[model samples]
Target: MADSIAELIFIPAPGVGHIISTIEIAKLLVTRDHQLSITVLVINPPPTFGSGSAITTYIQSLANTTMDRISFIELPQDKTRQDSKAPMAAFTDFINSHCKHVRKIVADKMSQPDSGRVAGFVVDMFCTGMIDVANEFNVPTFVFFTSNAAFLGFKLYIQTLSDNKNQDVVELSNSDSTISVPSFVKPVPTKVFPTICQSQEGLEFVLGSARKLREAKAIIVNTFLELETHAIDSLSKESTIPMVYPVGPILNLEAGAGKASSDDDIIAWLDTQPPSSVVFLCFGSMGSFDEDQVKEIANGLERSGHRFLWSLRRPPSDQTSRAPSDYEDPETVLPEGFLERTAGIGKVTGWVPQVAVLAHVAVGGFVSHCGWNSLLESLWFGVPSAAWPIYAEQQINAFEMVVELGLAVEIKLDYKKDFFNPKADKVTAEEIESGVRRLMEDNKVRTEVKEMREKSRAAVLEGGSSYASVGRLILDVKRNIL
Candidate 1:
């Protein structure tokens, strides 16, 4: 059976982050099981979503693989997204559009005798709609969850929020009651609920996806069990949900595309700084702020009086929503003389490689938007973080970090848009300074992060938990094939 071959079809959503992690998961599976092969199906993203140069470069780099086990199929751009819909709708619609293409592709693979058994389908977090196509072929399906266990549990348990089915989620979010979910150890404050889920469309989309996940054989999460023991355990005991696999901290370390750092200047600057000296402030690829917020950040960093590496990006100019672009001149939004005063202690640049910067010996503290991948990278590199969630499920991840796990220091300030005060800075200089200071100076957080760092590396090793989890997943897929 070990010598018998089988193939897994991967369908990742068009976002760069989703594609990158899907590739990592594919790579990890094939590496662990000699009998396995992978075929990745990529959806062509809309033009307004950015050039997708990052995904292009990443796929190109993998051209040198030793064995020709992994393959890619770029699906045609048949899905014309409704720009006015929420992001969740766009993703679901785009992926749902590709169902016929995927069905045809899988049918072709199944017909080819040389391609091996069609073992299973691995769909992205938002791509669960593909499960029906897999069902049509009588193949099992697995959902690759890109976030932490906490976020997964939140999504799965979120069906209870249907009482607000007719109400706007934003109004529901404003309610005074705390949230008690089966998966979380503590009651989550309404303030930290994901901003997107506060909308009617977004809530419906999230709940819809969560319900669909129960149809899969299991969910492959990008986190180690040791890091999220309570959430993982809570999710595993759920009889209704499918099997839960914790096979992660799966990261793409290539420079530029994902959390990789490749800038020569950023590396050189870090090389000169002393070990455990610099504080890194990088929100995820999409994180950026208005001029008021940018100024507040500068003030806060300056007040911290620590050596800093800040990835400062400007919000898109066209007012069409997209990832933040690097400022041609960062000094434009910065206060007068702010750059001059902090020149000796700080280096500001556009989009520093996150994992690359986090791995630096000089980086000690991280003030982040608490994206799941970024949080995992921070743990893998042993740097403590202060959570400043901007949007998406980050607020939930932040709550789990600050309240449930104590793995990160909390940055008190909502990153949500204030319609009443559009230009107002959400966080004060003092609050930012406080979070960074605690992250850097607090021994407890540093100690716990360092221990988790050891556990994270060990989890991927030969006999570690993640390694075992992958082994179990391989066995399950093979059994499904037979």
Candidate 2:
């Protein structure tokens, strides 16, 4: 008899962060069960923005190298709605527009005699609409949340509370008053809540996804059990949602492997520095600073009198653009003579291999934007962070890291307001300097982060929580197939 097969479908959103995380999960699933195969449905993003090229390249590389069991199918784009008012809106529109094509493709594949039997659909949290497609095909569906468990708990709790009064949570007052969330120890101050809670479109998007999650067979979060035990416990207790699976720290270490070849100059420079004496500053792909903020950061770095490696980029001309790719000359953005005076102690580049930098022994501090992926990488490497959130749900992540986890120092506790208001006051050089000093000087935060790093690494090892969670997920998929 022919070998039995278990195939799954993954529908990810149109950004680099989402695609990267989803791909990592797919790879992990296949590694854990050789009988399993993954068919990732890709959406053709507009030419101006999105991660189409990167995803295409990665899939092509996979086809030529390892992961032959994985395949990709790109959906045609709707040319009429290429332009959107915001990145979030654009992503939402793309998923809604292409979900029908995804369904058709999945159905066609299932009809083929030699094709593997479809067992499950793993949909990104942003692409939760695919759940309907899975239901139509009578396949079990799982929502892959590409964030921490605490954030998931926050979203579900807010949705439940808001439904009680038939009122939208985003429309609530943004005062300094605090509200209790299910899994958290202390009431979260309204000011540090997710920025989405302040916008109608964002709130609708989150609540809609949360509602969809309730119908899934299970929800897989990109976080481990030990990291957020309370949050995972809270989710597990809720009868409304599906089973919660904590299988994470799913990271792409390949980018770090070729660091010496791809970033020889930077690595060489770092080698000359003293042990644990350099600070590394890197925001996510979408992270950048205005001219004023750039100057302040330059001044702050110079004044801090520490060896530094800063990944600098100019802010996008369009605020709603997906990610910043334009590289600006350091002299153009930094204060006059700032580069010359700090040449001996600092180096600024357009982009660097972040994982490699964080893993290096010479690096001791990370000044980050508090994006979940970056935060995970920093923790995995045992580097203390100076939290500086920019957009999306980053503000909430920063607050959690500083207050709940005690693993990081805070630069701006409530930066979402300033991020949305261009004319808002910029963070001063003194504040940046103080934050950097505190992160580099504080031993308590460093010790805590080191312990978390060990836990993170241990969670993915053979006998770890994440390892067992992956096994459970694979077993669940196989049982569903039968």
Candidate 3:
């Protein structure tokens, strides 16, 4: 049986967040079916980013352990400078250029005897261009959407509407007008729409990908049915979209390998604090604030008077750079005497073992950028949050967490129009203090998160919604081979 196994090829977009989640999904697939093999085609990061090496190291470590069932092939470095002024345009162009390379790899793998039959292709949502390549090979293709279902529902709805018209219908004005999406009961504020929907180019890029998504055999989201039942139900009603699978909360279970720093000191600090007394603030890999914002955050922590463990990083030179930084002196960026005043009550570091810190008994609350991965981690650990979204789809995630899911306290719902622009109303120290206090002191929010936490764990266990979804996906792939 093993000798005649089928292989699945995965192509992930070029980012730490996308790459890590895609790798975890592949691991889950291989674990579920022993007769399955996976080959991940990794795209090279642009030369400017430094954290690409970390992703490479993480993938290599996984390959070393699962040598027989898993392997990787990195796309050649793209030396041609990305000419698109917008980030989405640049990423879309990059993925479009790799269809030929992926087609060749799929062809070569199918021809080799020991390589097994090429059963299908699993691509990251950003790499939907590869759907064309999969169609050429006459193999089933699945899209792994790394975010929640509400966002996916919104995308599918917008795509359906856009297909009917030749021009962009979404108004990009700065008003507080609301738009009704099919998934949510409440109308979404136009300002809270994804950054990609704010501009003509970004909208076109998203619409193009959404169109390609319709061609996939299935769409897999990194969320559970219990978490986003409304959104999942809404997407399921769409006849044009492919089958949807809620097979996740697929997290990086391993520690120490790809972490930016050792968590020994952070853990030691948490050990000294009382149970559920400290708040942990960590933005995602790309999350950082300007010096002004940092000073306000420092003041807010002091005013909140709660024990805190803040994983701080110097803001990047440019907004587009998502690279994690080397350790630096906090005094240079923080206000004078800020560290001295918060010494006993807080510990600030460049990076910490996020999972370990969140799992600590002392962690009562979280101040997060509301990246989907960070949000899931906080929920998985039963920690309530002060949602402070930074970039990408974070604002939408924050909105869903606070408004739709009832999981978190809102700090700023729509902070910015896009990454290139600053927030219209800067978040002040007073708002931060209020938000932190609400997350830490509110008993109802704490209890709700704890309940959600249990649900999250059960969803991934045997016979649970996420667990069954994974099984169904495996069976679906095997059925295709027959």
Per-candidate alpha-carbon RMSD to the true structure: 3.0, 2.5, 2.3
lDDT, candidate 3, residue 436? 94
Runs of candidate 2 exceeding 4 Å displacement:
1-3, 47-66, 82-90, 171-173, 256-262, 417-424
Which residue pairs of candidate 2 clash?
none
lDDT score, candidate 1, position 269:
87
Ranking 2 against 3 by TM-score, winner: 3
Write down the TM-score of every candidate.
Answer: 0.92, 0.93, 0.94
Error of 3 at 112 (Å): 1.3
Per-residue lDDT of candidate 1, residues 1-482 (tens digit): 55678889998877667877888888888888788999888776554655544444444444344445898877766635487865667667767988999989999998987778988999988889999999999999999999988888887767645643443455757675577877788987777777666666767787788889889999999999888888999988888879999998898876463443438778888999999999999988777888887888889889888889989988766634465778889999998899899988899899777767888899999998888988888999999889998777888888888778888998863565421223534698888888888888999989988999999999999999999999999999999666
Model 3 Cα lDDT, one tens digit per residue, 308-405: 99888875555445565644687787889999989989988986778888889999999998889888888898999989887777888888889877
Error of 2 at 239 (Å): 1.2
Native RMSD of candidate 2 (Å): 2.5
Return the clash pairs for model 1, or none.
Answer: none
Residue 10 alpha-carbon offset, candidate 1, angstroms? 0.5
> How good is model 3 by TM-score?
0.94
**In model 1, what lDDT does residue 174 have?**
67
- Model 2 CA lDDT for position 11: 87
Q: Model 3: number of clashes?
A: 0
lDDT agreement of model 3 with the native: 0.82
What lDDT is reached at residue 454 by model 1? 99
